[model samples]
Target: MSTLIGKTALVTGASRGIGRAIAARLAAEGALVAVHYGSNKAAADETVAAIQAAGGRAFAVGADFGTEGDIDALLTGLDAGLGGTGLDILVNNAALAGGTDLENSTPDYFDRMFAVNVKAPFFLIQRLLPNMRDGGRVINVSSGVTRIALPETVYAMTKGAVETMSRNLANSYATGKRGITVNTVAPGPVDTGHPMFQIPEVVEGTAKATALDRMGEPEDIAAAVAFLASDDARWITGNTVDATGGMFLGPRF
Candidate 1:
């Protein structure tokens, strides 16, 4: 079960929800994990504690992704935590979720969304590439909204950009010389702690939209991500794996 033994992984936004699940899953496979958080140090610590309690190794790293010098801050903390080891897996999972239609979206909100969801991952990867091992894996958490109509236009746009980045990066590294893999996992209607889950009607509607007849849980998406991060996925890259429970499976009749 220790598929990732002697490896290291960094998962952003590991304070809670999907990010936390991914971190825990990777650590379970014996990866020494760096659990990144924005401002929720307590939650990040809790994540690390849980991993440790399970006989896994993990540590908390803090960085506000959208802010200036964020990549530098993250790398600094990561370097201190890793001591001298290079990274084997990097999961870009931090993002801002709220966005409205064009008419309702403000310039500030759009900018912030792109900054956190798009710009941060771009720079984080750019900076981390040097430290990532030759056979490393880079996984971006994307949204299924990119493939379907969604009211959150700006959020979908950000995920679209991430998918594009993943494709280009994967192609760029496809030579097999370095063997690094870049990919995206797009999840639909995940039952995270987001406020949208507060409404019973919305939850019911979301469940109905999926072929599985149930909304996805954080672990569901994490399972897909875990598979992609493993050696079995060595040949897969530059693609979006739909972890959406067959959401939007067919045209509405």
Candidate 2:
């Protein structure tokens, strides 16, 4: 279980949902985790406390994405938490989702979506590259919307950009020289305690739409992330590990 002992990780958006689960899982694996939150100190603290309560090491770091000085703030907090240690894993799991369909999508909305989902992660990797040790892991959390036709056009586009960024990084000279592995994890309709998941119809429909005949959970996605962060996935890079429970894998006849 201590596959990551002596390693350090930073999971963005670790305040709740999939990010929180990923943070906890990394900590459980014996990694010193820095739980990053976007303007939610209370939730971040709760995540850190849960990890500590589980006999894992974790600390909270806050930086609201898509704003000025966000990366600087994040680096400051992350550096403080690491205490001179280099990072081994960086999970770009934070994003702004939902309500970006064609009719509702505005210029501002589209720009912001790209800003948070694409630009932030790109720059983060750039800035954090120096602080990350060789053979480090960079797992970008993307959505299956890149493959599935979804109403959230803008949102999907942003994720598409993320996938591209990940692949490029995986093959880039920087990562190649440092032995860093970059990959993406795409989840399909995971139940992250959103209100929509509370509706029986929504749950049933989503479950039936998947080949697994069940709805996906945040933990499901987190498990995949943990694997990629581990040394076992050292040879796996420039790939999208689908954590969607076989969603939309043809009609179940």
Candidate 3:
């Protein structure tokens, strides 16, 4: 945890749920965090306030993601926040989770989800990498559903892109033992504040599927993200950490 002292992190979609938890965790571990939200200013500000109250440094920033001006300003502000310390970590945690089966999914659904979940992370990293400190970290959020062949092909495809990017970026970055690592964090059925699926039957069924008798919490995923960002995980690049509660053990249905 102390490994991140004096560093800075830019975490996207950090207004609530998983993204917010990750931002707070990073801050608690001593990184000055920039909480990036797409439109939820209130939730983003609350995350920043919580971090500061915990004696950690944080700032809130909003970017529509994929818009030229927003991305540009986000990178600029991220660079400035480092104050010459350099951007030490980037958590591409923002995503649009929607349900659509192969039989009825629309192209528009695919486009919007890909733009946010895949395209945004791809370009955001490209724009921010130059300002990043050497031997820094990048973590992209994937999902255990990819393994389960979940209903949302568009969303899963985007996350697969994230996993591939983790490998490719690790190869391109991390020169000469400077100790940078890039990895994917995939969580399964973590409570992301969307309780539409939180019915007793669903919860009970999900719990029965896991060795642990319950679904995952956002902090469960956040803790894994924190580890990948830490020096303790320097040699763990190009890998995907499965934070699922044994939920992807077999088929979905």
Badly placed stretches (over 4 Å) of model 3 are 173-178, 250-253
**For model 1, what is the C-alpha lDDT against the true structure?**
0.91
- Which parts of model 2 are misplaced by more than 4 Å? none
The deviation in Å at residue 31 for candidate 1 is: 0.4
TM-score of 3: 0.92
lDDT of 3 by residue, 1-253 (tens): 5668888899999999999999999999999999999888998999999999988999988888755586777776665666666788999999888577788878887778888888889888887777577778989999887787877777788888889888888877343255667789998887776775568888788777776778889999999999999888877888899888887476554
Task: Compare candidates 1 and 3 on TM-score and give the better one.
Answer: 1
Give the Cα lDDT of each candidate: 0.91, 0.93, 0.84
Flag clash pairs in model 2. none
Q: 1-253, model 2: which lDDT tens digit per residue?
A: 9999999999999999999999999999999999999988999999999999999999999998999999999999999989999999999999998666799888999888888999999999999998799999999999989999989899998999999999999999999888899999999988889999999999999999888888998899999999999999999999999888888889677
Clashes of each: 0, 0, 0
lDDT of 2 at 93: 97
Q: In angstroms, how far off is 28's CA in candidate 2?
A: 0.3
